[model samples]
Target chain A: MTDSGFKKLVLSHFWVAFGAFGVASVLGLYQVVERSGLIPALQSPKVYFASVSTHGVLMAYVLTTFFVMGFGYLVAVSSLKTPLWNPKLAWVGFGVSAFGTALAAIPLLTGRGSVLYTFYPPLQASALLYIGAALLVIGSWFWCVIMLVMYGQWKKGHPGETVPLPMFANTANAILWLWTSAGVALEVVFQLIPWSLGLMDTVDVGLARTLFAWTLHPIVYFWLIPAYIALYSFVPQAAGGKLFSHELGRVAFIMLLILSLPIGFHHLYMDPQQGKGFKLAHGVGTFLVALPTLITGFTISASLEKAGRQAGGTGLFGWIGTLPWRDPMVLAAILAFGMLIAGGFGGIVNASYAMNAMIHNTAWVPGHFHLIFAGTTVILYMAIAYYVWPSLTGRTLVSRTLPVIQLWTWFIGMTILTTPWHILGLLGQPRRISSVVYNSVLTLAWTPYELAMIVGGAILLGSALLFLYILWKSQTAGAPEANAEIRYAGYEEPETPVPVLLNDFKLWNRIILALMLVNFGYPIAQFFFTKTFGSIGWGY
Target chain B: MSNLIPVHPLEKRWIYVVLGVIALFLGAIFYTALVHQVHPPGAIETIDSATLHLGGEFAEDKLGVRTDADGHLRATLVAARYGFYPREIRVPEGLPITFRIASADVLHGMHVPMTNLDTMVVPGYVSTVTTTFPKPGEYPMLCNEYCGMGHDHMWSKVIVVSRESWKAAAPQTGR
Candidate 1:
């Protein structure tokens, strides 16, 4: 396929992804206002829940999956300097995923699949929802196969050479997704689908949860790796700096692949079926995963510092101010870092075995996730969209100032949104409630925070709409023959003679499989090994 | 394919510092659990939810303060659709109270709003969390998990009174 052909393919994928994101953003704002109990007409539990469920599925599943697939295609073609191995298969995947999204969205919008995007059964939804979800996952698996095949083709053609960093990370994520998604896939195939279809009278909810837990946490990394790829590959170059260490970047990717897969039991820490021993094991592994993030933070900061120094900065932190913040990519990185610091601290507390008592299932959990997902991950997605729009559409962004303002507004809005969410959680306000107008002293204390969240949600909604406008404007605006090309950050040093394992995922994939066996082997097997009761589906 | 610049010394040094901090955080988390006796909720416990209310420890009348053979106060509570069984649990202040809770139907999280005691009560197993109330006061306990439509109304009370008052309130044989 020609470059324009490739661009058209990826652009179509992103348009679908961002379209879902736009609808979800509006639904999210409606939820915040409804939950605040500030408006009477908007406060229906049925409507609120349907909106929440749709918003969650659209943002969490549709947006992230489609964006990653589209971005992966771009990365594979650009980094490998070749067309997609099978462009036809890619379009098929996109069509299947988009159709599946529509199938699931029907139930969610109609209040039929109001199980809150979590298949924590007995609270079951329509069979179509499960089948639709399964199809979405299955569609993405096609992307995985394509990514691996293209990666393999590249390595075979160019023997004894380093895989480009962006392609390597992209492939690692593909491998991670393949492994990480299996748990949920197994759950859907065995339990949820059968139960939802009424083929099974009762389903083992414990097994369902255990399997879902396997997919739940690592999937965050699935959403996050693209952001990390942009950080490592794009941000440094955008800032006029080289990566501090290419070797460290590879190590971080490896660590994420290995550690992110097996430590999902942290999500099940408070779960009763699992033993304390397993939870502690997963908790330790969860903490270990933090190391790679810390490494990323350090490496990225050092890279930025190097950039600032080259631009005549002095002193310890003064280099921060000297770096080019005008560039949308650079500004997004700085903003993402700020949110990461705050969100990472929340995550540490959530991961702490003892400290989890303070915040588990509270509003704090959502607060932390939104900051990480929306604040950190989506900001980078926004930046990447901006960075590549010119190449994809052969059109210049309508206004340079719009993107910078939108980024700042997103950052500001997220801070306003999550800060009080953390406080409300600490104040013992439970999450997943449609309204909090109980008229108690404790409920009264939550009112101010609820109002604050409404303000934040409004700002976020406005920012999201503005973002879509910019992207739309960019596509429709007149072409500029700027001939913008994909530019990845280069390493400061020639990488040390690296082993073949570091270059490719073949050995690493096997190692991850082994680690999963160790981490979850008995935990999952014990369910079948022992006598476990089944619970019938309850909610519609 | 071209030769890049050499690795920066300071960047290498900072990587070590970040790694070290991560190690320290891990150690600190484990130390509290292993040494300080600050255990995670449901440290290790399970119960059959099918028979939860029919018979066994969490049966209706047996849902309040029950003293073990060794004189440790154990509170057995069951969380269900819209409420916690034994809507009121009386515990003596200034002593460690062990709360063993289970979910009868779906997933329910138990949390004492004012205390450092919170845990999810999942069906098929019991969750045990141990903590002490330093002062005598009534602390509201609520279900943190979204069990169903009635999840918002799932609230209970943990009434912590003086030792003599708790003893007086308890049924003599049950204790």
Candidate 2:
């Protein structure tokens, strides 16, 4: 089923993603160690901010975009049982993205682009960084086009047929990305780029933040939908059971797409540009988005329960022990869910309009996101890589036990790293600082948590290296495994023909546009109408 | 739709529970916001950040705690790349203190440890957060957002004295 060209394409994207991940992990360790204030020789705020910026861009933008693109390609090809639409164009997109990454890396390494990933202006970075970022997103737009085109073509060929569930979710992600990226895209092209290039003397900081808030929340769903895909489509089969409910999976994906977009103002709750009415509106939308996640938790748990019972488990709690624990995918799912629960609790706090003031911009923000992004999302990316590596490379994984061990270490390392981070946040330690120079009793109490973070970061670094080694060894030297074909989980019951509203996205797109207009229309337009001031660019 | 894809009875019940949980959270948020008047800092006041230091409420002498004509307490502060203006402020406990902070350059954040006095001071906007300090003590006011290379060093001190002592001390200068 694997075409050599398509195989090479997927592997290339994955390599870029993991290569960026490996470098970011090293930088992550350096940051924790430097910020700990124990290593006198390593405490340079100049270097620390630069490293933090690069680490953020690499992890948040580079790794996520590349991995999601590669995974989407694999799912489209394998699940749809079709050749990639315009293979040449796909390679072109990859080249553009890779070149953009290289261009961005130059400024990032030189300390000229240390504006951090959020890059809130008038704190400016090099214009090249914004341009490179714009190019990277432009390249990804090509993937969105490819995914949508293939989706349309498949529907045309098989009228009224239910699309493969993985592809269904993947296409939803593509549409979501198209909408999500537009916010940052507008900001970068019109505001940041011009201001950084000296074409504009000053930028409306409120408008810039408003546009970014448009991208801030929904972009999370873009990274997370792929993880959900793995959970719904792959984890069940890997756990030796069928999916509990196929319709519910579709419902969750659509709900995530619509509910996630209008709620981004929750990020701007603390800002003065928007009014309380709009903030409360967005706050409500934020909680509404949590429904899909809860549904996902319930559906996946039920699927596993059924699987466990099917394997000769009798008692109420015996089903848990009966499931496959050694399987990398199964273990990764369990770990991912455990972290999601923890991360979700923190997310609820962030969403609460008033409670947000307690933790906004503190270390708690980073702790919550790292658990969700690095812990839950990226861990599942690793599991998906392990699951499909055999099919993609035509080789067996180098060591079975190494992956199991790797997943466990990643989970344990994240728990260690984020737990103390939350505590430090509560103790009123700010994030994105090089050291605690206050020298007060309150500052003294933060030293222990800083040290704990170092240990957690070291463990995570080691685990990341192990993961890359497994992938490299498997691709290069391991023997080929015969009959390495890809298969998604089957349904518990035969899949009935889904309604057009559930199967198609036309209605959802309309709802999203209407929601965006209602939620963001006045908030953004008021910036143009009111007497607002713009600030000139400033450099660190 | 139901005939096309009937949901599992257990899953249907779960959906109701999910809605109930969401309602509870929203209810709590609305109750506090409407009844108690506890809301996020959202004052939509604008200022020219570049020239903020020249002459304004955030000028050098005009900063720090002040008493208004209505006998209300207010604090005006300036945030820049490195530190907060005045670097230290003394206020009375058990009184509602309105903090009107503006950034001179770039974006900054201010938070007093163990209090709800937290906000982002965007360059072009004034972040106004009002709250009462119940406990009288010295608290560290830390810059929680990354402003520049000197971000870690960007902090100040807040001395919360008793209301009686605040009256005995020199009267605040600015109106």
Candidate 3:
């Protein structure tokens, strides 16, 4: 009850995050409808591309960065049972990020920054957008430093004690992010900002893409680890059971941080910039990262099963029926896992060295990511928000039924949307097109799928609005909840001693440094050694 | 501090299953890449995208299917803002045709649907991929990556004709 300052801090960050989400959802609906070519009045390539760019920036950059920062703060304070490392500094980071978002919106809304979120050069957007994006990332670095410092402080104070699992996972994400954002940050500061500002005449597109690929794959992991944190830290306790194995959770976090960094070349599988050996090497790493997710899946499922059985469930499958589906966190986890299974399958195809050609840059790419990032990751974000709203706001939820409905609708809507998207990819439909103006037989096959996506988008838009409404109502009008204290899942068995290696990141960081040097050192250095011709900026 | 907890027995077995699944995938990928010579396009050839059309291999006159010195067919193409150069090209079916494509402006991705011939034509790099078209048909080759405003219209055709007819029509160019 005395943590009002922390509550205010968390709520401020979440508001910015969800505000971006709300606007992006509206843009997403427009994009699906317009791209369907159903409404003649809505068909404009300029607007469509601009909307797509804005939507991507909002969801991928704004929403994820803010949400993770806010959530990390919450985990740091609540799990460590300590005051925020630097409250004023945290507010400054939020201010810088919010200001950057507003600055970027200037160009994005005016159709000047239509270069999609990838912003692959030599296609250029307004320099303001790049600078804004750079600022946004810089601000997140502040959050990262804060998280790491708090983590180090906690460990120093409680020598040889296992860092609380939530803080452990949260700190791992902070390290992962600092590593992940470095690639794009270098590209932005060194290449994009100068090139877009006309300070540099030409930029090496290959290097740009290589750097982006470095960031692209791991950024997903960055967004995902917090969701994983929610699953590991909250789901079991919320389900009225204990964590199945705390050690496995720590191992999963460690694996994610190490394996996710050097595997980005899988995104460049079909690009001509890198070599086959490097691509194959990165592809292997991509597959290695999946192991942790599989571990997590097993661990979380077992935990849920234990919870279900404890609630008087019997037999093999009966435990599933006994699970408290009405609990928002439990429902979200189940839905998220289901989506992860489907999305992970698509990802495997993408990471396959030769198999990537079948669907690279096709609609399938978006389909897979939407299923993973938006479907699985964001759904869990929603669940975490719902579970913590009472503690954060010191009020009861306005409507529990609305949140349950919202989660189901999100899952259903995502399934409806991405199913056709995958079908279209198989049909050879390229992604990022404004309209189906090809009028060919292959494109004709995509019409029904496009139509299906519009319906999906509308449903998702409704769900997003409902989510924001629920949060708004809970914050403003809901009755007070006096006993709202955050609780994390506990281990089923008595605590076992944790190894120094698992508890600390020093060895892992060193391993990551070596792996990154091996994976990227030559590939990136090759660009400088070769007689590369940089290309001048071209506007959309 | 105590020692690290041993992984649960059931979880250890599950971990093995996970590793097996990953190994199976890696096996398939390695086999296709090594034995079948099937791999993603990773041609590290660079060109000045700004002046690509002025002369040399991607010059307008040199853009299309042609017989190389090795007697293998190679298609040289250029992807610009709105369309692929040559708009349409005829290649014989059931023959391995290597495509060496580059972007004259911005970045683009080329994919012939239902085939494994897909590569991103980065502005300053040549994207090369080789594949055989078994069935004769007019396949639409579309730009999978967004280039600019005219991106939706950025598509061409790959007309795969019967080998005999293609040879008869252009015997001098045909192997």
- Give the per-residue lDDT of model 3 (tens digit) for A155-206: 8999879899999999999999999999999999999999888899999989
Q: Where's the lowest-lDDT run of ten residues in candidate 2 chain A? A: A493-502
Each candidate's B-chain TM-score, in sequence, is 0.86, 0.94, 0.94
Of the true interface contacts, the fraction found in model 1 is: 0.48
Query: For all the candidates, what are their Cα RMSDs to the real structure?
Result: 2.4, 1.1, 1.5
For every model in order, the TM-score on chain A comes to: 0.98, 0.99, 0.99
**lDDT (Cα, tens digit) per residue for candidate 3, span B1-175:** 1235678889889988999999999998889889989988876998998898689988887888888888888998999878888898888899999999989888899999988889999988999999999989889999999999999999999888998998788543321
Which stretches of candidate 3 lie above 4 Å from their native place? B1-4, B172-175
Q: Write the per-residue lDDT of candidate 1 for residues A4-66, one digit (tens) a residue.
A: 778888999899889989999999889889988888887788888888888889999999999
CAPRI quality band, candidate 2: high
* Per-residue lDDT over A1-540 for candidate 2, one digit per residue giving the tens place of the 0 to 100 score: 558888999999999999999999999999999999888998898999999999999999999999999999999998999999998888888988888898888889999999999987888999989999998999999999999999999999999899989999999999999999999999999999998999999999999999999999999999998899999999999989999998989999999999999989889888988889999999999999999999999999999999999998779889989889899988999999999999999999999998999898889999999999999999999999999999999999999899999999999999999999999988888988898898578888899999999999999999999999999999998898867988999998787788898889999999999999999999999999999999998889
Better of 1 and 3 by TM-score: 3
- TM-score of every prediction relative to native: 0.96, 0.99, 0.99
**Best-to-worst ranking by lDDT:** 2, 3, 1
| Deviation from native of the Cα of residue A130 in model 1, angstroms | 0.8
TM-score of 1: 0.96
For all the predictions, what are the DockQ values? 0.48, 0.84, 0.87
Better of 2 and 3 by DockQ: 3
